[model samples]
Target: MSSAPGADAAPGSNPIPAPSATTPTTAIKRQTFSSLKVRNYRLFATGAVVSNTGTWMSRIAQDWLVLSLTGSSTAVGITTAMQFLPMLLFGLYGGVIADRYPKRKLLMLTQSTMGVLGLALAALTLTGQVQVWHVYAIAFLLGMVTVVDNPTRQSFVVEMVGPKDVRNAVSLNSANFQTARLVGPAVAGVLISAVGSGWAFLFNGLSFGAPLIGLMLMRPSELYEVERTPRGKGQLREGLRYVAGRPELIWPIVLVGFIGTFGFNFPIWLSAFAHSIYHAGASTYGMFNTAMAVGSVIGALLAARRATTRMRLLLGSAMIFGVLEMFAAISPSLWLFVGLLVVIGMFGITVNTTANSSVQLGTDPVMRGRVMSLFMMVFVGGTPLGGPLVGWVTDTFGPRIGFLSGGLVSAGSALVIAAVLVKAGGLRVRVDLRGRRVRFVEREPAGERERESVVAGVG
Candidate 1:
């Protein structure tokens, strides 16, 4: 098997390897969907698709409902912020909890709680008792549950498929979610337009059963074993220190933090674009989301096909994603805008899956939960800050200017991070205009080169 960069390094002390090309084996090349060959993961993925579809449905419904009630993009942002606020506050603790408990059991509890919350929201909306505060309250509660759920679910992938297939599984998971994204928004748009958001919420509430049942059906013996961290103090501090010491792990998390915080406020942007800019209805909003999902699915599949993750890929994709968003923000026509959304979705998922797999592979299995929590905390948790800010921007300035500003931040941060990584790695950028290529090459001092030559001769 092709080794991931720094895959063999000690936890918290991994050396950041200089950029290198990867060559996959014939067998590895043929196993794009290799993770699905395992029955347990297959079952897990099957159930996830159903639940994720419901999730997207609920998300679209919730955003639309808030906008409909308040007629303000900022309110939709507040709603989105409420749903992710707990991650900002309590995300690290959730990871510790995941490490201390059986992931399957933890998942069951979190999933059930989320499902109930969905039902409760549905009841409020259907009975005509729903208010902005009710939606905000339920969203906050859901965020609380997700604190536990996100890490448990993330760390569980390695157990289901083992390290060999973790990257593939991660990519497939994205593909699965994007696939649902493709379906959920379309269905939600129709439901919201016809009956109201209530039924969409109800469908989401019922969707949790699929994953719960799948968890129950798994053969525990067939799953890979990972050592669970015992209950103790200092664990949270340890997780943080472990990550802080590892440049490979910490830098990617930082890059994702910037991208996630500013680059991914799609709910606010899309809703504003549909409602105010295009003067379109819920169906058009759903269509916009669905178009993006199509590109995301393609991106995920491409990631699944790769045998190795590279730092350059992550940086390049992030930069591209931001640039595309900037372009899409200014597109003059609806078709041109929708087309850009597709490409933006593609690079966006690429950034996500690459960062995810890179972090997971570099981390020790024992510390995986906490490391992933930090990864996720920066990735989604910052939404509490970004969502409201972007929402306000859209409300005050206009959707075009708001989106352009986010894109600028995302692209700019990526460039800065790339420079930092290059400097830290003691590497120089090599530009071969003749070959039309750019590469990172180690900077070898004359003394070091002479020493290496003498040593090679002696050997």
Candidate 2:
């Protein structure tokens, strides 16, 4: 049976239910924790929290390990790029795999592969046989698996909660990830300082067990399975064709590519702050990350309460996030800089979560995997370019310059995207300070009034 409210109503016999200001069911679903009501999602979220924490721990440990070996921020940037490069190259192929196969089974395989890789890295580090090259190799290997894992994991949310709560589920997912970020780095910091980075890696390797167990315990009957995309020629081309026709999809991907490339060079920036600028160490680095996570959590929670994603919100938040990050780059004191990062983190998460939810919601069910794969490809995969650029900036000029440069590019990109949206959304950017007016002017179908609501948002 169709789950929509009026699905069973006779075509012309019954009076329609009035769409009122609010209803009990709608009110209940508006709550931030609404998605947790589902057993599968709850279980999966529980497992993910544990696993995401471990992932963060491994990330921090990996970067720190690289710095310790090379003493160069550029090397750290390279490591970051290497990890993401595979996703840039192969993310679409993963999407095809995702569409053709069962998502749950694919997740299990990918998750197990990740766990093994984590353990292998831990073994190498603990045995003191680890080198920057070894770390690079392992990071690249991990990214290879993530090419498949990223899209599958992203598309799996709908399977857990169905289409109705997807937005809420995605918001909660970000909240879950940020919460892990908050806890993971703090724990890893202590573990790194007290024992060594090896222990942190080992702990992360062990943390995979929780999610694996959760997956094992899920009831197959409860899974909300979408139609499996059948094998066929030109499916990949079709996915590309679908995205090409939508401006809403194109703009977000384009904007995210810029931000992800320049703005999200955090591993390089934060690492340099600790090792190069602050002269502190692992604890301070972890603290920096934790503070950012704190803001991210808050941003995610706020996103949950919002009615819908908007173009103004996305561009506005990105602009603010970039400017704040630039400001953090110039802060004179470590504490002051850390304080700035907190606010930056908030805006960053706002931009990230909003972009993700918007893209997923706007896409078709069958085409979602490919669409999201492209999104991830542009967002994380752009690291191949951004990482190296930021690294070179950090090494040639200074960490502060790298920081300032990234923010400048990020904020600039947002402005350009805003302009693109203005023209493409059938709206004009008019500044009338003398007339005391500042708002979007909706031009008649003179331009793209059509795609505006679908891509950008309603004015």
Candidate 3:
């Protein structure tokens, strides 16, 4: 027997519910930082702030080092590509490892390895032996570590704070990262201007101590119990099938893949703008990033306040993100471009947080590691393809053309995917000219309702 449309349904059973105008006042009033109340998560987040700041500092330093050494945007792209290539090739296996092991322990090992890599780079750069190739090697090794670290860290949040606060925790994680971003680049700029990239790398290498200590100090007893998957074959295949069957999971991943591969090539574009177009130096580059970080921090904080995620919100934000990128790409003045980047950062983080929370919340706990690995893979792994290509476009044509092309692809993909999702859900656009409103509403045909009911039941 099929339940009637609009009837109460188990969470995750209805993959696509129509948007509601009225959110409960209590949900609205929920504190944005509620997840920080958990001791374990608080520790983890505190450590993350220190480490993420170092991570961002390293990123800016690394990019500047490569550009200074090679003077070719293509070479910079190659460096970025080499770093993420591991994620493209070995990402699924990393997820398997994350599932079968204790995430906290795995994170400890990975973080330690990454710290060593950072220190090694620092050593080379400080000694004046740092070639572009040295940075490339280190970046690739760092990516290899990230293959394990990214998914493990992502799935670890649920254990720290439990399900009820997972979304809040995820939002706070973004906020933490963006907060670091707000600080990291500015500091890196001063350091690079006064000293060089070597000191920044050294700081990053040493910063890992914070996370290591935090992890060691966490009380294991307070963590939510989650069943770890046993060692087994075909787990990778099983994960692929799981996402392949779920529209909610699959669609977001697909959308991110498109956006990530094309739209998120900021390293290439930002550097080119600073070097070629703006005729500026490392400090100006850092300022551009800082401008974007300001918006990203705001966006993450806003996302933390929302108790729920919506597909419409994700799509809308993504479209706006693409449009803003396009405008920023062509701005005549440096400050105008910087201003556009702020709005771009806002919408960019909005898309990221919404998609992240939606996927994490909708997924089964046991499958989370694999699911998140796939998410991270697409979200970042595609950088290998995007980085070089965007770099080439920027090098061969100009930064404006390269950036504009990425925005075009991003916006075009969102529109196409939006149409596909609407059709799949048997939905129609409801426009009320008098109210100046538009939203998606269910189609009224009985057959369509029956079909949707059947699909919901199966899901």
Better of 1 and 2 by TM-score: 1
**Count of clashes in candidate 1:** 0
- Residue-level lDDT of model 1, residues 90-136, one tens digit each, is 99999998877778888889989989999999999999999999999
lDDT of 1: 0.86
lDDT of each: 0.86, 0.83, 0.85
Native-structure RMSD, model 2:
6.0
Provide the lowest-lDDT 10-residue window in model 2: 1-10
- Name the lDDT value of residue 419 in candidate 2: 82
Candidate 3 structure quality by residue, lDDT tens digits, 55-170? 99999999989999889999889989999999999999898887777888888999999999989999999999999889999999999999999999998888788777787888
- For lDDT, the strongest prediction is 1
In candidate 2, what are the lDDT values of residues 132-227, reduced to their tens digit?
A: 998999899999999998998898787777766777889889999999999999998898888889888988888888888888777666666465
